[model samples]
Each structure stands twice: as C-alpha cells, then as structure tokens.
Target: MSKRATIHRMVTPDHLCPWGVKAKDLLRRSGYRVDDRHLKTKEANEAYKRENGVDETPQIFIEGRHVGGYDALREHLGKGPDPKEGKTYQPIVAVFAVTGAMAVTTMLSTSTSATIADGWAWIRVGELCVAFSMCVLGILKLQNLQSYANGFVQYDLVARHWVPYAYVYAFVEAGGGVLMIADIATLVVAPVVLVISAIGAVSIVRAAYIERRDLNCACVGGGSDVPLGFVSLSENLIMIAMAVWMLGKGSV
Candidate 1:
C-alpha cells in the first residue's frame, strides 16, 4: 500500500492559497494517497495553525509524521531544492534562438543550391544573426527604458559618464541592426557599432573579469537577471566582429 499524506490547505471565500494547491499536487504526484483538508475560514485556519504549532498553512504530514511546508516536503521526498528557482536565461535563450532561426532562413532564401558553399553567403548569414540578436536585445531594453538605463550605469563606461547615453543606447543598437539588415549605410553604421561595442567589451571585462564584481548583466535587458560575465562580453565581441567584417567587405 502507498503511504498516506494529509495536506491542510487554506481556501477562504475570496482567497485560495496557491502554496496549498501546490502542496496537495506534490503529495498526490509523489505516490501518496492524499487526505486533503481545506480550512475554509480564518478561525478554522488559525485554530489548525495554533494546534499544529505552525505559523503557515499548506502543512503536510506523511504517514502521520509532520513534513512541514512545500519546501520541506520536497526535502522529505528526497528531492533537493531547485537550483534555478530564481535565476533564468530565458530572455537570452529566446533572443539567440530567434536570431539563429532568422539567420538560417535568410541563408536558405538566398542560397542557390542545397548547401551554402559561397563565402559571401556565409558572411551575410553571420551579419543577419548578429544584427537580429542586437535588435531583439535592444527591443527588450527599450521595453523598460528607465530600468535598462539604471542598470547600464553600473558597468557601461559611456553610460556612467553620460547618463543620457544609457537612454539612447538601445535605440542606437536597434537602428544599427535595421541598417545592417537592409544592407544600407554600412560606412556609417559599421564604424559606430564597432566603436561602441569595443567600449562596451572593455567595460564588461573591467567590471566582471578585472574588478570581479558580481552583478546582473543588462545585455538581455534590465528585466533579466543574467549574470555579468563571459556571455555579455561575447555579445559585444560578436557585434565588433560583425562591424569589422562589414567594414572590410565594404572597402573591397
């Protein structure tokens, strides 16, 4: 026979405790025959809490032994706490994935044969990938411009010196990306992107690698919690490389 679990959850008229629902679901999924007890009133809930000597609801008991709350129950079930409970790379992943897809689509559309053998074709694909990634990142930053600007001052050299630059940085990146995609104004955009990205790269390296400051990266936007590290540096380097490549090609 499976072990029995009792979950005491609070469900008032106006409120249904989310943690309680999670506890009940976890217990059921863990092969426990759950006896779900709903405390539907404040008095009843308080009485239960007082009786159990626990300050919170959504208390769990497995085989008549107290298993505490959701986190405690997870431990009791032999599963450790989630490592990535707070931090996430979802925004960065989304940006890169979309950029890669767009690059591939552009390559396929422009290619003459099944395989992309032309060197120039590959360069165009690379440019598209970098440009698209920049556009996406810029759009994310522009979504919450104030937050992005606040975060930017922490590491960006220009933004630290000139506050207005932080506000305009996202627009610059997006504009450059659009021009790159359209294959227009390479003489202007490439040099501008190259200089800005080089400065950003230097700033990131100083803050993250040299100074060893543990901070959040604003690369994916101010809303993201991505760490300030190699990934951010890599982003700037990619833009620099793209700009250099475009400039070199334009000269030829």
Candidate 2:
C-alpha cells in the first residue's frame, strides 16, 4: 500500500498559505496519498494553531506520526534542509558563468580572426564579461528597488549617510556598464568608475574586516543570500582594475 499523509493548511478567499501548497506537492511527489484539510478563515486557522500548540500552518502527519511544518516535513523525508534558509553564492556564480560564455561566443561570432590565442582579443572578452555582469546585476536590483535599498543600506558607507544613494547605485552600475561596453568617452568613464569602485572597496573593507560583521551582499540582488565578504570585495576591486586598465590602455 502507498504511504498516507494528512495536512492542515490555511486557505481563504483572498490568501493561501504558500508553505501549505509546497507541503502538499512534496507529499504527492514522494508517493504518498494525502488527506488535505483547509482552514478557510483567518480565525479558524488561528484557532486551529492554538488548539494544536503549533506556531505555523502546513502541519503534516504521516502514518500517525506528526511531521511538523514544511522544513520539518523535508527533514523527515530525508530531503535535507531548505536552501533558502542558508547562504548561497549560486546566483552570482550563475550570472558570471552565463555571461562569460556569452562574451566568448560573441567575440568568436563577430570576428573570424578572433581566437583565444589572441592576447588583446581575450582581454576584450574579459572586459565584455564584466560589463555584461554589471548590467545584469543592475537590472536585478532595479526589479526590486526597495528590497535592494534596504539590504544595501545595511553595509554601504555611502548609503548609510544618504539613503537615496542606495536608490541611485543601480543606475550608476548599469550606466557605467553600458559606457564600458560601448568603449565611448573612456576619459570620462574611467575616472568615474575608479572613484566609485574605490569607495566601494573601502566600504567593504571597513565592514568585513575592521568591524567584522556578517552581511548579505546586495551586489547580485537584495533577495539573494550571498554573503558579503571576499566575493563582494572582489567585485569592487575588479571594477577598479578595469578602470585602471582602460586608462593605461589610453582607450580615450
């Protein structure tokens, strides 16, 4: 016989508990027959919780044993802990990996003579990758400006002094990225990037080194759980390097 599970979840005309939906889906996928119970009103849900002595909904029972909420259900099923509950660098790594592949493909497609063996061509590819990454990350932040600003202000020195700076950071990264990719107005662009990235580097150093605080990096997006430390510091330092490289190459 297939295993059997029972779940109590909150469901109302205007709202549905997300965890409840997930728990039901998980049970079905794990080959269990589910007895779904929905509490249709806020008062009903609260009363149920109070009666059961549980703080949250989506409570599960399998074979007469209580399995708790979503996270607990996952643990009981041997699916490991929920990834969203912990830090992850997957977003940033994915952005860089995809953009890097795009840069190589673009360079090869545009020029028959372009090869990885060509030193200057490889340098150009690297620059394109960085510019593309910046633009993509900027778009992510812009998609949820308020969330980005909330996280950014926690660690950014400039944002700490003036809250509006958090709102403007996305535009600066995207604008500079566009200018960098276009290879126009290098004389102006290089200095601006240099200054901004230098300031960012210092801010990261103070927060991660001097003060020793663990923080979420707003570089990818505010929703991301990537830690603010080496990777975040590397981003600013790389921007500084790009600025210096452009200036030294006399791209103006």
Task: For candidate 1, give the lDDT.
Answer: 0.87
Best lDDT among the predictions, by candidate number: 2
- Tens-place lDDT digits, model 2, residues 130-169: 8888789889899899999988988889999999988777
Model 1 misplaced stretches (Cα beyond 4 Å)? 10-18, 38-51, 84-90, 109-112, 115-120
Query: How well does candidate 2 match the true structure, expressed as C-alpha RMSD?
Result: 2.9
When summed lDDT is taken over every stretch of 10 residues in candidate 1, the lowest stretch is 82-91
lDDT of each: 0.87, 0.88
Flag regions of model 2 displaced more than 4 Å: 113-119, 143-169, 221-224
Any residue pairs clashing in model 1, and if so which?
none
Q: Given candidate 1, what's the lDDT at residue 90? A: 67
